[model samples]
Target: MIAQRKDDHVQLAVEQQQQHSGRNQFDDVSFVHHALAGIDRPDVRLATSFAGLSWQAPLYINAMTGGSEKTGIINRDLGIAARETGVPIASGSMSAYFKDPDCADTFSVLRKENPDGFVLANVNATASVDRARRAVDLIRADALQIHVNTVQETVMPEGDRSFSSWVPQIEKIAAGVDVPVIVKEVGFGLSRETVRLLESLGVRAADLGGRGGTDFARIENGRRPLGDYAFLHGWGQSTAACLLDAQDAPIPVLASGGVRHPLDVARALALGASGVGVSGTFLRTLLDDGVAALIARISTWLDQLAALLTLLGARTPADLSRCDLLINGELRDFCADRGIDPRPFARRSGGLDVPHEMTGSTR
Candidate 1:
C-alpha cells in the first residue's frame, strides 16, 4: 500500500496539475529599486543559518517524493545536485519508509550521495518522538521538518482520520528531538496566530508553506473519483501574504510555496524571510530537463538572485528587509484587514499612500 502510494505521488508529480488562480500575491508586491546599488554582484551574499546549521544559500529543497524506484532515481539525482551545488536538500515524507523498511533505501540514498551536505528529514506533526528520531537517524539529518497538513490530510481519501492530538504530539517531538524542528505548513499559509503557537511551544524556525504553489487539494482530489473537491481548489493564502504575517514573528521564517522566480525569492527576503524553499518547480525542472539542466538552472537562479539583490541595494539576505516595498492590489487589503499594516512595506522610502478598503471583489 505504501509503495503504491509513493508511485501515485510520483506519477501525479509528473503531471503539470500544480497550477492555481493565485497571482502568487507577488503581483501585488513591488520592491523599490535603487539605481545606485553601489555594490557589485560578486559582493552579494546569500549564505544563511537555520537551527545552528549553515547553508551556502538562503534556499533549500522543500520536501517531495520518495519510497519508489522512480522517486529514488529523482532523490539520487537531487542528492548529487545538492552535493555539487552546496545547497541543502530535504527528502519527501518518510512515513512510507517507516511503514515498509524495504523502502528505506529510497530516502537513505540522499545522505549516501551527499555525505557532508545538509539533508533534512520530514514527517507528519503527529508522528511520535521515536518515529521522528528514527527518521532523523535514517537520513543523518541536520534538521527535521514536521509538516502540518490537517487540510491536506482531511482531503485525502486514505489519509489519517485523527488530528485532535497533533499539538501535544508536536510539543513532545519538538522537545525530544536533538536537531532543530521546523514546523512546516503544506501549501496553506501560516497565520501569525499559528506562528505564535509554535513560538510558545519553543519552535525556533518555521516554513510558512503558503499557497500559490502545488495545490495539494488538487493533487489529493485528483486521486478521487471525478476530482470532486474542485470547489476547494483555490483555498488558503498566498506565500507573499504569509511572509507578510511573519514580518514581526519572534522566530526566523523560511518561505515556501509557488516560489517560481528568483525575483520572488528576493521579495520573500524583503518581507523578512530567513531563507526560501522551492520544490515543485525544482522537481519539474529535473523531470523535464534532467540533472545537468537542473544544476544549470540552480546556478542561473542563484546568479539572478544576487543581481536582483544588487538592484535593490541589498548586499546580503540580511539587507533585504531594509528596502522599502510597495503592496498594491488585493494583497494590500489583505494586510489591512488582517491588521498587518501594509504602511511599513512602503515606509522603507519614508512615506506613501495606503489604499482604501475595497468594498467588493479583490483579485
Candidate 2:
C-alpha cells in the first residue's frame, strides 16, 4: 500500500509539472542591472555552505520520490545526476521504510548510487529520534531534513490529524541526531515565527519549502474519491514571500518551491537564501529527457548561474546579498503586508558610481 502510494505521488507530481501554468513570486523579484560593474564570468563562484556542509553549487536537487521500484528508478537517476553535477540530493519521505523494513533498499539506493556526494535523509516531524537516526544511517546522510507539512498532512486523506507533539518531537530528534538537522516544509512556506521557533529548537537550518512548485494538496486531493479540495490549491505563502518573511532569522534559510531556473536561484540568493533546491523542474527533466540530458541541463544551469552572478556584479552566491534588487508587484505588496522592509534589498548596492572605463564604456 505504501509503495503504491509513493508510485501515485510520482505520477501525480509529473502530471502537475506537465499541467503547471501560472506566474509565481519569482516573477515578481527582478535584479537591478549594473552596467558599471567590472566583473568577469570566470570570477563568479557558486560554492556555498549549508546545513554544516560545503556545497559545490548553491543549488541542489530537492526531495522528489522513493519507496517503490518505479520511484526507486527515479531516485537512482536523480542520484546519478547529483553525483555528476556535484550538488546535494535529498530523498523523499522515508516513512515507508519504517512501516515496512523490506522497502529499505528503495531509499538506500541514493547512497549506493552517489556514495561520495552529499546526501540528506528525510522524514516527517512525527518521527522519533531513533527513526530519524535510522533514516540518516540508511542513506549515510550528511544531514537530516525533518519536514513539517501541516498543510500536506491535513490535506492527505490518511494524514495525521494530531499535531500537538510535533515541536517536542522535532526538538528531541534535533537533540539526539548526530548530524545537522534541517527543518523543512513540503510545499507550504515557513513563516518568520516558524523559522525562529526552529532555531530555538536547535535545528541547524530551515528549508523554506514555499508553495509554487509541486502542490501537495492537489496531489492528495487527486487521490481522494471526490477531488473536492480544489479550493485549497494555492493555500500557502509563496517561496518569495517566505524568503522576505525570514529576513530576520539568524539561522541559514534555504529556498525551494517555485525555483525554476538559474535566474530564480539567483533571486533567492539575492533575497538571503543560503542555498536553493529544485525538485519539480529537475524531476520533469530527468523523467522526460533521460539521465544524460538531465546531467547536461544541470551542468548548463551551473554555468548559467556563474554567468548570472557576474552579470549582477556579484562574485559568489553569498555576494548576491549585496546586489541590489527591485522588489515590486505582488511581492512588494507582500513585504508591505508582512511588515518586512523591502527598501534594504533595493539599497544593498549603496548607490555607488563607477568610472566609465571600469564599466567597459568609452564616453
Over the stretch 26-144, how does candidate 2's per-residue lDDT look in tens digits? 99998777776647787877899865679989989998878888988999999899999999999999999999898888889999999999999999999999999999999999999
- Model 1, range 217-301, lDDT digits (tens) per residue? 7778888887887887768888899988777788889999988889888888888888999988888889888999888888888
> Pairs clashing in candidate 1?
none
Which residues of candidate 1, in runs, are more than 4 Å off? 17-22, 349-363
Give the Cα-based TM-score of candidate 1 against the true structure: 0.93
Which one is best on TM-score? Answer: 2
Q: What lDDT would candidate 1 get against the real structure?
A: 0.84
- The superposed Cα distance between candidate 1 and the true structure at residue 331, in angstroms, equals 0.9
RMSD of each: 7.6, 2.0
- The window of 10 residues in a row where model 1 has the poorest summed lDDT is 351-360
Cα lDDT over the full model 2: 0.90
